[model samples]
Target: MTKTNVIRQLEKAGIPFRTAEYEVDEADLSGVHVARQLGQPCEQVFKTLVLRGPKLGPFVCCIPVAEEVDLKKAAEAAGEKKAEMLPLKELLPTTGYIRGGCSPVGMKKKYPIWLDETAELYGEIAVSAGVRGMQVILAPQDLIRFTGAKVADLTIV
Candidate 1:
């Protein structure tokens, strides 16, 4: 498997993860499309989102590819008054990851991450591998432990 920063970090942490590579279309990069490309159900694929909250400067969130992050719920989970998506222009600088390649693991800094509670339904889930065209699949619980993520109802049903 081609090792990316995320994979290397998982390896170092003794986290067992499997990788999958797919053709990427930079112009049409979306989590839903990624799931389709990987031949996986949208629910089994999670997308990493970075948000800026009124109280917290920046935070991370993960939700199913097909679900949208519930801002109110996310704010409650983050213990903030409100949370908004970090601007695209600021994403790269703030998280050290481009919009389409952001992963909850191995970010420039460990921003607090809130994972959707639905993740627990699956034994394993796929997330971006700090790069486009690559994905990593691992146990949701292991992902939570590695990222110190809080499980909450952060997505709209």
Candidate 2:
């Protein structure tokens, strides 16, 4: 298996992780589908989202595949008045990652990252390996430490 930048970064940091590769369906890039393909619960798979605030510019949030980010909470977490999803056109330029393959670990720039509090509920969680059809599984705390991510209730109930 080819090692994505994410995997290489983790290895360089001495953080242990495992990768899962599955067939990718262009039409169904949802994390839910990825979870099903890996035989893992939906909650164990996280989707990376990039959002921007007028003042903060850009930030990231990782939430369960089936849940939605609470923009209000996200804004509050970022110390902004409001936050909105980063338009698709700007994703690649802003994060050096395209849709369906944005991994919080290896963005072009180190933007603030927030991992939904629910991530702590599991011993391991899967996140994009910086490419389609691949996922990196590791302990949530390790990810938090590696990425300097803040944990919070960024998801809607």
Candidate 3:
């Protein structure tokens, strides 16, 4: 059993999931190497984004590679006047992730995490393993249960 904080939480909550590990240089975050190494389509590889409302408030969103999160739509989802991806400088301190490796689980705070509905289209999705060099494949429903995320129409196009 892996000894990550996320793993501990999953086990404590009794969420069923499988862990996948791969070797990849950490030079790129969105360069698509992990998906290829994992033998999964890019569409099945999900990414975690930490966004803040235009008003400088906190928000979190996760979307599959198959779609993009409309910032305006995301703002509405967060009940804010507007939304935008926070600056990398801000994300590093606020979300505690280095721009690309942020996962919806085990964040610094329990901010609102909205998962795009399209993610549900896949019975299972690969998400961050709460650390670099790893990923977790699990039922989408299980992720929802563990992350306390609400399923929402998070994409605009």
Candidate 4:
């Protein structure tokens, strides 16, 4: 696969990472499916989710593919009274990324990012490479350094 902005950015920053490519199934663009395709445990694959807080506008939350983001907990961590997922139609315009391909890194603009605490359990986790059908695997600490993500309880059981 041709390189995407996310890959280029990681390279430019000298962040060590490896790419994994898989077949695209437009109908099932779920992180769990991507993990299955990559032959990895679902918990190691995190999906980037964009949410709009009524008081704070847009922010990002990265959670495990097998789990869901707890909007209440996310809002609390973000210091907002409430937070809701951004409408699908606005994702591309807001972050320059499509629904299934959004990565916490290399967005059109920088927004506060939160990674589920579970990410620390692994040495490296997989996230989209700013495009569908590909993922970038890197150390969780490296990803945190690059995105300024706060490790928190962002996922639901």
Counting clashing residue pairs in each candidate, in order, gives 0, 0, 0, 0
- Estimate, for each residue in 30-144, the C-alpha lDDT of model 2 and write its tens digit: 9999999999999999999999999989999999999999999999999999999999999999999989999999999999999999999999999999999999999999999
Q: What's the TM for model 3? A: 0.87
Better of 1 and 2 by TM-score: 2
- For residue 84, give model 2's deviation from the true position in Å: 0.3
- Over all chains combined, what TM-score does candidate 4 have? 0.98
Residue 90 deviation, candidate 4, in Å? 0.4
Which model is ahead, 1 or 2, in terms of lDDT? 2
Model 4 Cα shift for residue 124 (angstroms): 0.5
Model 3 lDDT per residue over 102-128, tens place = 778787788888888777888898888
Please provide TM-scores, in order, for all candidate models, with all chains considered together. 0.97, 0.98, 0.87, 0.98
Tens digit of per-residue lDDT, candidate 1, span 1-157: 6788999999999999899998889788888899999999999999999998987889989999999999999988999999899999998898888988899998988799999988999999999999998999999999999999999999887
Worst 10 residues of 4 by lDDT: 148-157
Off by over 4 Å in 4: none
**Tens digits of lDDT, candidate 4, 1-157:** 6799999999999999999998889999988899999998998999999999988899999999999999999999999999999999999999999989999999999999999999999999999999999999999999999999999999776
Estimate candidate 2's alpha-carbon lDDT, on a 0 to 1 scale.
Answer: 0.96
Misplaced by over 4 Å in model 3 are 54-56
Please tell me which predicted candidate would have the highest lDDT against the true structure.
Answer: 2
Residue 126 of candidate 1: its Cα lDDT? 98
lDDT of 4 at 135: 96
